[model samples]
Target chain A: MDNFEQFFTENRLKLDVEPLPEGFNNQMIANFRAVRRKKQTIRLFAAAGFLLLLVPGIMLLQPFFKPEPVALQESPSSAELSILTRLQPYQTEIESSTQFISQQRVPTEYSVQFQDFLIQLQIIDRQQDIYQKQIDSYGYTEDMIQQIMYNYELKLMVLQKLQTEILKINKLSKTTNHEYTNIQLEI
Target chain B: MLGNRQDAEDVLQDAMIQAYTNLKSLKSVESFGPWMKRIVINQCLHFIRGRLNFADLQLVNTPGESDETDYYQFSMEELNSTIQQLPDGCRIVFNLYLLENYSHKEVAEMLGISESTSKSQYQRARQLLQHQLKKKMNHG
Candidate 1:
């Protein structure tokens, strides 16, 4: 036999090569079962951890689905009152303008000039009121109200200038020989 | 010998655990030692990958610790332990050829090594054993 073969056989003889210890097979089987059990335990823990991660997500979605009742606290302040007061003038102007247009064009679905001016004015007033209330009812300070009012006033001035320009055009067209070529009244 | 025996033992224990853990995926029952050996080797490599500078690894000899004991005089247990003491690659080749009766080609295929490598390892193992046997005879 080759030296490797001889040595290997000799070494093989030296080895007890017994089938493990008495009950060793049973022990190994038990160990294998324990290892499997451990893996299962780890998997269970992983699943539980994943479920735990979803808890906040589920809570966030619950608010979107069946929302909890939010109690609105009433705490209207001077800023809110001032905002309503500022909007009152624009609201009166629109109402008066619409009334005038309704009287002038009795049975019209909508007087375009009146509707345009009133809607624009109302939108500006609504924006100002929203800011005012955010400051007052939301416990915003006087300084914040002044800041929002300043912005709203600048916007109102620009709209008023635009309205005046429209009025000038209307007057010049009526007095002069030139008629408004594009003034197609659907009503 | 490379590190603390406790550390090596721990690594071996871990490798055994890993082997058992992944036992279900193991298709062949007979390939358990090789699988365990792979894990042990990987663990060892991981422990000393960049840290160990293997300059003379090719020249390094398999452990020939003692020059005692004739072949037949040694008990089966002694022989098995000595075989186990062989370097990782040589021990594997020895087991496959001697105990399992695997051909060199089969061993090479199984280990993903060249046929020449398997043959050479087997030859080296034979020479080492012959030397040990001769020493034992001279001493007696």
Candidate 2:
């Protein structure tokens, strides 16, 4: 190299690479964590809000979920009431699982498909309720109790299937749009 | 270019944050070093542009400046201090073109100035540095 180039090269070599300011890396990591926490808080509030809207709607629609008491001549036995109480936990699980599935971010094309899946789950829930009402009316026979439990399992399975489908779609989208990989890394 | 260590640090921090946020958009990991340097340079330019009006960069005329022989007489420390004293526009063009090995065209594109402007700024920087170095040598 000529003296002009050599002069610059010597100067460049002499220039020191400055050390990062004290606590800078820690500060940066903290900022990133704070941003991530804010996003999680927002998501939590949204999920809570959705549950708030859903619970009251379900309560208002209680009549549709039950057969009229006048239709049954005999009062339900303790055994039938116990069966109803046992099913409550499964019902709560299904509701929360459905909520989780609906909260996922999906493409526009899959939204209609997701809606269809939800409708199918609702149909299954109504079927379970119908079988539950039959147990109250005809007395809790072994066969009737088994049918109700079967429908409960079916609802849970459908919810699990929907969750799996949502996860698959999320993975596919992340692969296609490379920027989404950063979000996944943050999570 | 930023003239002080504090301003340089601040710009570095901001550039690092931006780079981390957009890291996933980078296609190859091998390009990370150059990518980050570009981000830092851009941040420094942005900070300078925001604080200093371009129209205020007074064009200096230093006719009969000392020849290249004066630069050979000075120590590296003297050369460095003289570079640090250059005006912002001249300093930036000098650093990018000479030290950083960026072509005038690339420096112009990076700084959003015309190619001719980059060349003139570089020439002006060299002239000023040569003059300052000669003065220091004569005094010392």
Candidate 3:
């Protein structure tokens, strides 16, 4: 070792490091506990504050989402009123045809198809109502009102054609059964 | 070498608190002693740097009275007292290099100074400590 290194080594050998202050370890552990407790308290407060904000936030948003009951007898827009008036003449005829078709004895295989067509009519009626409401509330263009009228006329034509086909099938089945009874009498 | 025992104890305590708080970040548990020692050294340096400005370190003159021959005859207590009297920068370098057994390169890195500066500061501290010890020995 060099002179300075040797000298430092000798000095280090002779040097005495004082023992840590009495009860230092216990004091440190106590300090650590206090610090930990403080941190946990801070975290608890933060969680409490978050929950306080969250509960009121959810409550405040509930009313905006609660479904309101829509009132009946609200006057339709003038365009929709005119369209309904134009369709008034066909209303009785369409209703009678629908009742007759419902009363007819359809084949079990055709029952599901007939029910599906009725459902389609109901869906179209609902869609037309929604479009009418949109036009009234949003000041939709005349072209939009015309489109709704055209769609309603098309649905009426489809129902009329379905009623005619069902009536023809019923008449054919009645004739076929009557002819079969006559042949049995002859045999 | 941190001026007094009270200051040294305070730094040690603060370093311990810091070490405990950040213990989870330590990668090697076996190096805990050296890691804590580094923290203590850093705290001591921070205290010294706060007490004495960088300009003051440059202004401190190297003691001219003593040579290496004077250090061998002194008692450990005398040597310690003499070390404490060194200027802040020199004493820090001396303590880190001699007592802490850090290399000059490590001392330079720790102090954020050039290696040559660490070397010169250490030499100055040794010379001043020897000079102070010589005076005490002659008087006693």
Candidate 4:
């Protein structure tokens, strides 16, 4: 060991910890408490924020999230107007996507599935037209709006199912055509 | 390793707070001293990481006397104050290696420096400390 190392080792016990500043203990305690309190306040705020979001989210989605349909007897209300306003976009979306489907070429003849999709679409369309006439006559009762939204949603679902089937058939047709090309090349 | 007195005290207090909160995770009470030291040292290392530039410590010459009594006359407080006055890089390397008994490898890994750099800084520390002590001795 060097002279300094030797010196330090010899004086190790005599080497004092730095003399504490004035009121060091009191300062430590106060700072510790402040830090802990700050942490708890932050945690409380986080939980409060989460609950604040959750309650309104549940309220706004409550109607759509209902497992069983509510009986359509409520009088026309602002809430119904808001729901109808929100649903207007969905109505446009369904109509446009439905139109887009006719523009797409049918990749295969899934006769039974295609027939079922057509039948369901026709029935929902007929029901929606009836609801529209009733709303026109009665000035949009809550029940009429709900029925119209329900018909639109059902039609969108059937169209989505038919579109998925068509996509699957398209993929199968592409793979089969590739195999046929390989066979022709070999021959 | 933070040169400022108040900053060092603040780091020490934060380390204490960390140790107090995580005390339950300690496996044994006997190991508390080293564990607490680890916390404080970690806090200090974190504080100095942004400040210490390892590239600046070019060791000029080796330090030490053949006689083991060269610094025997100096008080521990005097030695400590001199150490405190050291440049941030070597002071930290010295504290970790000599005082804390960390291996050169461990010191390097802890300080995010190469082992050779750790050794060079340490040698620089020794040279600087010896220079200061020699000045003190001549004055006294």
Best candidate per DockQ, number?
1
**Residue-level lDDT tens digits of model 1 in A1-187:** 6444555555553354644466654565567778889989999999999999899789878747642212223534554565568656755665554444333321122235445655665676677777657544444455554656565565556455545645555565567674345432221
Candidate 4 Cα deviation (angstroms), residue A129: 60
Q: What is the lDDT of residue B50 in candidate 3?
A: 69
- The fraction of correct interface contacts reproduced by each prediction comes to 0.60, 0.27, 0.30, 0.30
Candidate 1 residue pairs in clash (backbone atoms < 3 Å): A3-B126, A4-B126, A13-B76, A14-B75, A14-B76, A14-B77, A14-B79, A15-B76, A15-B77, A15-B80
What does the lDDT read for residue B66 in candidate 1? 43
What value of lDDT does candidate 2 attain over all alpha carbons?
0.72
- Positional deviation of B79 in candidate 4, in angstroms? 1.2
TM-score of each: 0.40, 0.50, 0.47, 0.47
Interface RMSD of 2: 4.3
TM-score of chain B of each: 0.49, 0.84, 0.80, 0.86
Pick by TM-score: 1 or 4, better one: 4
| Backbone clashes, each candidate | 10, 0, 0, 0
Misplaced by over 4 Å in model 4 are A17-187, B57-69
Model 1 scores what on Cα lDDT? 0.57
Error of 2 at A109 (Å): 60
Model 4 lDDT per residue over A94-118, tens place: 8787776775555334444477777
Model 2: per-residue Cα lDDT at residue A11: 62
lDDT of 3: 0.68
- lDDT (10s digit) by residue, model 2, range B62-136: 454435563556666667777889987888888999887899899889877888778778878888776776677
lDDT of each residue in A40-123, candidate 3, tens digit only: 899999999999999999899976754332222364466556655765656666667667656656544344445656776787
lDDT of 1 by residue, B51-130 (tens): 54432122334454443333666656545555555555665565666766678898677655677777777656655555
Candidate 3 CAPRI grade: acceptable
Task: Show pairs that collide, candidate 2.
Answer: none
